[model samples]
Target: MPHKRRVYFISDRTGLTVEALGSSLITQFDIVEFQRITLPFIDTVDKAREALAEVNQAHIDTGQRPLVFSSIVDDAVRAEINKANGLVLDVFERFIVPLESELGQKSLHLLGKSHSAGNVKDYNHRIEAINYTLSHDDGVTHRALDEADIILVGVSRSGKTPTCLYMAMQFGIKAANYPLIPEDLEANRIPPSLLPHKAKVWGLSITPDRLHQIRKERRPDSTYAALDNCRYEVAAAEKLMRQTGIPFLDSTTKSIEEIATHMLHEAHLVRRVY
Candidate 1:
């Protein structure tokens, strides 16, 4: 096994940009393993310095040099992090220097403004409601599967978990997922647990080749993750879904947003929020 690499992303808030950059880097290195640590909302110089020190200690303890990806907006705060002893890639420093020269104007300050005071209360209320729903989420509750807003049934790795999470998180939907195991496949049946929920049931299908690639990344040696087995399972699962009169969405090419939106619209379910 190749030695794993640790990557840290420090940001004023959310760290979304740095996360995107880290994801892009991972795609370029097929066989390397990368671990990500996000230090969000490190707005002050002291906080930024502390984060850098933590990364430095981690590198020394592990004996592996980690990469630092950062999007610190404040130059004074960024200066504190530059003292670290690893490869550091600051998004603002890297882009701002070249961009300032290109644009011929000082870059505008862009940070610390997420939501306004007038909307913050409403936003917080909605966040609270969503968190409550997720904790009390009835999606996985047994004996109540029939009441699911959307019931997803498919073979493992057919994008069931992520789809369900997206539906729940994005729309406040109570989405449930049931995996179609080998026994279910061999018997040519949807699970008895989901039979009563057939009206609300929806299938998620993936291209076998894509499924193979996803599974191989997760578990490289298993026959269950091999291409031939993936093809067999996907085909059988699709046939069973069709025979059982369950409508399905192919998830191979669509983003999670698109898939969830299609299901909501097609099923006539009203979306509570984005």
Candidate 2:
């Protein structure tokens, strides 16, 4: 078994920034295994010391020093964290000074600034987008189809719903998705309702084997889950998308994040939320 190293993500606020940054770097070291824990809202010296104790305990237990990735803005709290018996990677200290020097100004060094809900307008936009996505899911309604920033057309379980949801939550884009049913596939055309907004439509297709596996997990032994049906649906859906000149992606191997980001990039859609 590979030895698992301990990693701590520490922050003064939600700890999301530190966790994301640390996790991204950790993923680069595929050969090494990591056990990560996040300690959020460590705003006081006492809390920082408490977190340091946890780090120290992990190091003692594992006979290896834990790597600490911290995003604490307060100097005193951050200083306390530095006393841990591990190598500390300070996220703010890593770039803030050089950024300040380049911009010829000092940083405000405020806590929770990275992801705070200070911008009520942007926050509201994200919430509204999420609501819109939920309502329009699975072609539930076409009343406000024009309001959608992007619409996804795909076979069932081809990864439309999650991709739409992620785009709404992360980028604040109002996404709507519709599944290609047997009628639409046999007709070899997108739904009539979707055709009106074809300019904003994107497609997601999966390989026959992948679609079969996914469907079998949902409704085993049914025709919907059968390999032969999955093959027919995939081929017909791809052909429909191609004939309509709607750009499509193979979602079999792509992560939801990758698909959403790729759609945003290809369509040149602006991100309303960061």
Each model's lDDT comes to 0.81, 0.92
- Supply candidate 2's per-residue lDDT for 251: 92
For 172-218, candidate 1 gives per-residue lDDT tens digits of: 67777788888989999998877777898899899999999999999
Tell me the lDDT of candidate 1. Answer: 0.81
lDDT of 1 at 256: 87
- Poorly placed runs, candidate 1 (over 4 Å): 1-141
Give the TM-scores of the predictions, in the order they appear: 0.54, 0.97
Best by TM-score: 2
